[model samples]
Target: MIEEEPRLSAQEMIDRLEPSLSLKRRVRAVAALLAGLAGAVFVSALWWSEPDPLPGRTQLVFALLTVCCLAWAGYGGWLLTRRVPLFATDRVIAAWMGLAASAATTTALAAVAVQRGTGLVPALAVGGLFVAVALVLAVRAHARRRALLRRVRELTGREEK
Candidate 1:
């Protein structure tokens, strides 16, 4: 027997759905933007304000760090301006980006410690913590995304019939 389409109101539909872009997400997006911009500015200032000329390698490293910060700021801005709500998929992508960033930063710190022949142990310990946290977040994000996808499929399949 054919059933009539269920008339779900807009608010009712929203109430039933999961993962709206909430206030917390907006605040996080803003925080990311501000932090990235501030970091870039601070790094650039340090890079340019040194009394003595820095080595070529140092200059290149500063430039790369600045660019990375700018990229993060751009990502935050994009998130803020997006018309659609960011869902589990976006979270997964962001978590992975964080993991990569943490890994890169740890590697950089480790290299510098080795180069200077000091503080290697502390650097590794701190970096390891960062990497571990990022890995956990990424894994959780993937799991949540998978669960959301499964739920969506189930809901749509039921609705379509």
Candidate 2:
């Protein structure tokens, strides 16, 4: 005889199926939401408040960067609130977002250092570190994606022809 799932209210089903989150996970969610929101606000404010005139293209780039961080905040909020079987984080997209953010931050920092007549070496060192980390993440995401595709093909006995 086939066993059937127990009949339960939606809330009961959710409470039963979902395990309690640990402190680390809770902290991560909060950090993501807070940091993402702060980054978006700061970037927008900084650009708008700049005394120097910014080109239209530069304005667009800043706006896009704000949207990127906002997207992350939305994802984090979603992560914190979901109560049932739902989609998990898309790691590849997350990694790419990280890369984009790292690049934008590093470039802005470097530009500021140069503009302020501050030594470029220190800024370059910090920027290089972030870029390196982003590159590693991008590489890992690509590899993981390829491996998953390969595994799927193996399970289906379908060779890529």
Candidate 3:
């Protein structure tokens, strides 16, 4: 006779947050490592093998944004590996997203300042705007995730009772 695996209870599932590494964490770690590698490669490319000084404002802007995007992707990976309570997961994710966005914005500002050969004022203003927009998006996504989780809990609770 074939043996069947025993199912864990909801409490057991909740308890598992600390002990076992979830699939999400593993995936995030791998993805983050990849993204970090990619960022390093891009920075190196811009540094070493340049044919000439990039000639125009548009090219500079695009390059700066590309770097920021890569960095943010890596940060998203970091958020994926974190452990948080079911009810608080949305908040935690949003916080991490905001943090990553801020970091990206800072990096972008630095790039802009260096490339433009100008003062910090313009860089800071543009970067700050990018960060603010990212934060707003993160908050909205968190709210949606929280609502979905709440509905799931309600359904599961009904089944148990």
Candidate 4:
């Protein structure tokens, strides 16, 4: 025998789910903001430190990474502010873009760290650690967002309706 799914009124759905969605979105936003702040600090360090080999190239890469972080934070914040239903594909697209931006920033940071003449092994190890952590977080966020989109579809009672 097949069981029918319980139907919930729109108000009931909102009441039951809005808080959880809001909390998750807030957490993601905070993470993005913190990442952006970290990038800013990195940029400042590059600017104030004694000249490194190819200082110009290092500075350019650092600046690009910092900008990506800032942009990610701003985009995340805007999504939160707009309350653009998480079911929207735009959320997924933005998340994907943010992931790319984070990876790019991580790569640039590693390059800058290496160019600064730090011991090769230690510099590479630290950079790899940072990249690994960021990758894990990004993957987690992407998975959660995908689950959220699926839930939204289930609730709407439609598959691309």
Candidate 5:
């Protein structure tokens, strides 16, 4: 006769796994904090090193967009540091990051187009490509989130809704 091992309850499994999970969370939080810091530094460097003087209105808009990107990255890192459930919130954060990146790229491309006196057609094409990439990234993030949730539910012996 083949012997089968008894399955542990969710609580029991969690209790046993909590220590490792806590460690993993701490490591992830540290990584996020580092990434945020690096991004801030890079943006600052780029802003500082710009060679030409921009119009007051253009400078303000650029500053605002850069700040928004830095803020979003910092907020995401902070949330990760707080050890919020990854499967629950990480996907949303990832999507937001993707959107932010797309916006920044669009802004940069527009600036380049203006500086180079390029026609609208090339700029529009580039913008379209960026949008397509962003959409793919967002979709992948959501799909990964769903997969993670499903796996968690399976591990806990819960039925999928």
Candidate 6:
């Protein structure tokens, strides 16, 4: 006769585990919400304080970027609030955020160089370095997530796909 192991629900598992996990998740969710609120405020201030008019297309692009940032931040808050396992998605978000930050920094640096009539070579080099670092970190994050997921599957006796 084969013996079957009982499966515990997420809540039951959490209850059986350390209490600190829930506390940490709740704290993280609150922090995320606060950060999102701050970002929204900052964006609102920038939108309200535009001294010079931007071209229509430029304005549209800015608006879209703003929306995307806000949405991502809001989604982070929502995800954390739901008490979902962050290991599944947090690393992916971090990777994309790193890339986005690198692109934004590169653009800003290029813009400043152009305004100052300075050479772009230095800016490009620095931007490239930042992007490379971001990519490396992202790759590491993904690798860690994969390892963690594998460990989880092993502990749960789940078959690998």
Top lDDT prediction, candidate number: 1
Error of 6 at 13 (Å): 9.0
lDDT of 6 at 100: 80
lDDT of each: 0.76, 0.70, 0.60, 0.63, 0.65, 0.67
The true-structure Cα RMSD of candidate 1 reads 5.3
lDDT tens string, model 6, 1-161?
99999998755553343332367656765665677667777876777688677666456546655665676577567756554454435656667776887877788778778878998889989998999988998888887667756665655667332
Which of 4 and 5 is the better model by lDDT?
Answer: 5
Q: In model 2, how large is the Cα lDDT of residue 6? A: 79
**Runs of candidate 3 exceeding 4 Å displacement:** 1-40, 48-104, 107-117, 158-161
lDDT of candidate 2 over 1-161, digit per residue (tens): 99998786644543433334445656776788898899999998998898778887578778878898798887678667854322123446567878887887778778878878997889889888988898898788777656654544554555432
lDDT per residue as tens, model 5, 16-100: 4333236655566566566666766776777778778867756766576567656655764665545334553554675667677
The most accurate candidate by TM-score is: 1
Candidate 1 residue spans exceeding 4 A from truth: 1-16, 158-161
Model 2: how far is 48 from its true place, Å?
8.3
Error of 1 at 129 (Å): 1.4
The local lDDT score (0 to 100) that residue 148 gets in candidate 1 is 59
Candidate 1: worst-modelled 10 consecutive residues by lDDT: 152-161
Worst 10 residues of 2 by lDDT: 82-91
TM-score of each: 0.79, 0.57, 0.41, 0.56, 0.62, 0.65
lDDT of 6 at 150: 66
Off by over 4 Å in 4: 1-7, 18-54, 87-102, 109-118
* Per-residue alpha-carbon lDDT of candidate 1 for residues 7-122, written as tens digits (9 for 90 to 100): 97644443355445567777877887898999999999999898678888688789878877887787778778865534465677678778878887888889899999989999
